[model samples]
Target chain A: LAKTTQPISMDSYEGQEVNITCSHNNIATNDYITWYQQFPSQGPRFIIQGYKTKVTNEVASLFIPADRKSSTLSLPRVSLSDTAVYYCLVGGLSSGSARQLTFGSGTQLTVLP
Target chain B: SAVISQKPSRDICQRGTSLTIQCQVDSQVTMMFWYRQQPGQSLTLIATANQGSEATYESGFVIDKFPISRPNLTFSTLTVSNMSPEDSSIYLCSVYGTGLNTEAFFGQGTRLTVV
Candidate 1:
């Protein structure tokens, strides 16, 4: 399993674009980057997943450089409701069974007005 | 995504007692896993429950302390044995159901407060 490192916390104003970067320098070729958002008292929700280059979803966009050493999750026009902890996970979608994920201490994002 | 429900969403238990948390999925799943989350902390994998076989526990967790059962594909249970203050945490169960691009779904969680 690959280890991930993220900032302890970050603050941003509402309506501004916020980007949270995660570093997984030792990522393997088969490893994929996934981001999850979690709110208080609730389970974490799947945000977006990517392998290389860029991947966009309805909620956010993931930017990965060619080196794949790090990835960034970009949230456009943040709101107070967007305040939550963001986790970066590196793993591959298994071919036959469930791929276990290890959730490390994630970056706590606070969206301020 | 599958809809999951757990029993006793929150409970307060006495020391040395045991509490069993139940997990139910709307559809049959291939894999089920249990996780423990301390307050303001990241999640820790407890074990993986498979039907008709014993659960595989992670390091620092034992089957005797956190016994698990998977009677079938749609349901599973986790028991917190000999509860103490250290066992006070949120226990969540997740399932990976059948599909091409499936993701794991988690129950609301069981908040166990042992005193």
Candidate 2:
């Protein structure tokens, strides 16, 4: 399993773009970086996933450098509803097989007015 | 994306008792997982619920303690046996779709409080 490190917490004002970076120095070649968001008392929800470069979704954007040692989840025009714990995970999707999906202590993002 | 439904959204169980958390997916999936999130902590994988076979548990987990059952492709259950106050936490179920470029979908989660 690739271990990830991220900020413990962050605070941002509403309508700002918040970028949370995750460092995975030992990420495997076949691994993909994924981000999930979890509000209080809820299961983590998938935000975005990317192998390299950038992948954008309706909720957020994932940017991975060429080295793939790190990735950043960018939330654009954040709102109070975006306050949650953000987790960065590195793993490979081997269909039909179970892989150890390690979740690091996520970064808690508090979007304030 | 898969829609997962978990039973007994929240429960308070007596110490030394057992509580079974059920997970049901709207579609059949091959990879189902059980996780535990202690208060103020990150999610920890408990085991892999393999269909028609014994579950593969993580290092700190065991078959007798966190027994998991995957009777079919769409449903699985996790039982926390001999519970204690320390076992109070949220248990979650997640499934990875077999199709390409798909990600894992999670159930709402079971909040268990052992007293």
**Residue-level lDDT for A104 in candidate 2:** 97
Cα RMSD to the true fold for all candidates? 1.3, 1.2
For residues B1-115, what per-residue lDDT tens digits would candidate 2 score against the true structure? 7899999899999999999999999998776999999998999999998899999988899999999999999999999999999999999999886554436778899999999
Provide the DockQ value for model 2: 0.62
lDDT of 1 by residue, B21-112 (tens): 99999988777889999999988999998889999999999999999989998999999999999999999998764543335567888989
Candidate 1 per-residue C-alpha lDDT over A20-41 given as tens digits, one digit per residue, 9 for 90 to 100: 9999998887888989888887
Off by over 4 Å in 1: B97-102
**Candidate 1 docking category?**
medium
- Which whole-number lDDT from 0 to 100 does residue B40 have in model 1? 91
**Ten consecutive residues with minimal summed lDDT in candidate 1 chain A?**
A91-100
Local distance difference test, candidate 2: 0.91
Q: State residue A30's C-alpha deviation in candidate 2, in Å.
A: 0.9
lDDT of 2 by residue, A3-35 (tens): 999999999999999999999999988888989
